[model samples]
Target: MHRLPPYRLRRSARAKYLRLLIRPEGIEVVAPDGLPESTVLAFVRQHSGWAQAKLAELQARLAKLRQGQAERFPAEGGSVPLEGRETPLFIEETGGSRIRVSLEDRGLRLILPRACGAERDRYVRDALFGWMKRRLPGRVAECVQRHGPQHGLYPRQLRIKSMRTRWGSCGPANDVNLNWLLGLAPPSVLEYVVVHELCHIRHRNHSRDFWELVSAHLPDWRQERQWLKTHGGGLIQRFDPVFP
Candidate 1:
């Protein structure tokens, strides 16, 4: 009723029905090609009530993720969610200007030079981002090993980085690109995404066959998928250190 929250209308030739995807930033309406704009507009307006409620919940979740930035990074009591649990951060001063970052079983460790206090936060962010980049490829390989053999599916190459719109994508050649921010999510969530992309290598679209393939490998994938739909946006919007 209130003019509907912000929305972007995407016309997809492959889209069979109008779909509404709600995220923290706004709404995404995927409409079949050649559909009338008026029809799309009406469809969105029809779901205004549901969309509003979903958006409110997402906004609140993101706000909680942003609380006490000091407790998130580059300060005392810093923590981050890793593998579905809050992982604490610890920093130790080294004698040189270089920063050393490593992931221990206990938590993330940052070795920063005492003289770099003026720019510690920036340096820590960069180091942690690098660690994220390094962390994802190994995980993807592990997922492929666990799920790819029987199906004979493997990626041409794996490219990991911080992506804004999607968690992962499979190229025509089956080279996979994954968003590093996914590392912050639960391990199951990450595997679901990896499996989703791997399926794309065989079936380019979201056909029944593709979904069957996914279900064959991950029977509980629907739960992880739902988790991403509900919490993934906040991971990208509020918890991505590069953006923060």
Candidate 2:
């Protein structure tokens, strides 16, 4: 553990509605409409303890996320899940940088380059993204078609992007966005998420109406949602890991 360092707080007006931001750079006080400088300073002084704790929590979470990224896929003798079974990862010395994956009774064997390192990580990440892009649209469309008919909700377009905090989003006038990370989850969980977003086409918010719509398609939505929140982070490993 590192010792806590003394911090110099600065007042900044760039924050939209957040009251305080305690980034590693420094503390930034978001100037709310009509809030006096003295009041904001006083608030900062009183809540210094809370800010430090929040910073500590963020640091710990970052460490955990990084650890997860490093171990996302299996290394030599490492194990990952296929369907519900445990499988071992075997690395072979392939001539080039390409990864060739094969699943067998021994689990999954991933052929790696003799010089595997950061470059190899990037290759795996790109491969995962490509697989997701190719497969997600049809699954998303299936969920949309099954549920959209009931509410006269039809989507104009469907796209996949890496999102920081959102699972999926429903834009105005029936545009839908899904997180590419959906590929890492199980088929049932992925289907649940797709249906959840499609329901938003009819009802935009997480209000009762929106939930009712989701429930109509997936009666066990709450279970799936909980699974995503608890285990979803496990699926969040990247070969070329990036964090914000």
Candidate 3:
């Protein structure tokens, strides 16, 4: 018999069924307060396959983090990947009070007040996120409009959010919700996610028919999917504070 790996077990007073959390720290097993240790062990054993897979995934993520796969906080001379390329970031202090950002031939340029103080990091993050908010909506709308019609799949609405666990989701009402962080990925990758959710409008489940619809629209979707699987975590982690 295969033995389960070492994990920390905890008893919750709220009294719920067994819940397992695989995090960067480690695996945690949460069970009802009165549940027998043997039962908890049995539960872990029952889900050993899933637990092992999740552990491997998390370990890979941690390894990527250690390798610095993405830039958390970009400085004046630093560069960030934008639209499939490593775009340089140029930060300059201007005498004006307002902060301005623009895309140049080499990369992105930001102009901030010379007297900008402790709030610089927040200002930069906000400026970048605001720029993405303004830009991504139109891009997503264009993708949906362009591809949705071809497949006879139309979504009633489109929403952008900072999703933690998913790139995008399609609701039963034909609403497509996309992760704003996708703007950091290559254009093809973003398009794949949009097409994926749009296909869900036709088939809500991940059945064979659903994937067939996706491939019909985006034949290179598997490559894009692999790109996200390899790079998505770094993009999602970009929101974490680098200074603090």
TM-score of each: 0.65, 0.59, 0.64
Q: Model 1 clash tally?
A: 0
Query: Once model 3 is optimally superposed onto the true structure by TM-score, how far is the C-alpha of residue 132 displaced, in angstroms?
Result: 1.1
Determine which window of 10 residues in candidate 2 has minimal summed lDDT.
235-244
Each model's lDDT comes to 0.83, 0.68, 0.83
Worst 10 residues of 3 by lDDT: 235-244
Worst 10 residues of 1 by lDDT: 68-77
Candidates ranked by TM-score: 1, 3, 2
Candidate 1: tens digits of C-alpha lDDT, residues 55-165? 889988888877745444546457667776778888888887877877788887888888877677767666767888887788878999998896998999999876778
Q: Which residue pairs in model 2 clash with each other?
A: none
Q: Model 2 Cα displacement at 165 (Å)?
A: 2.0
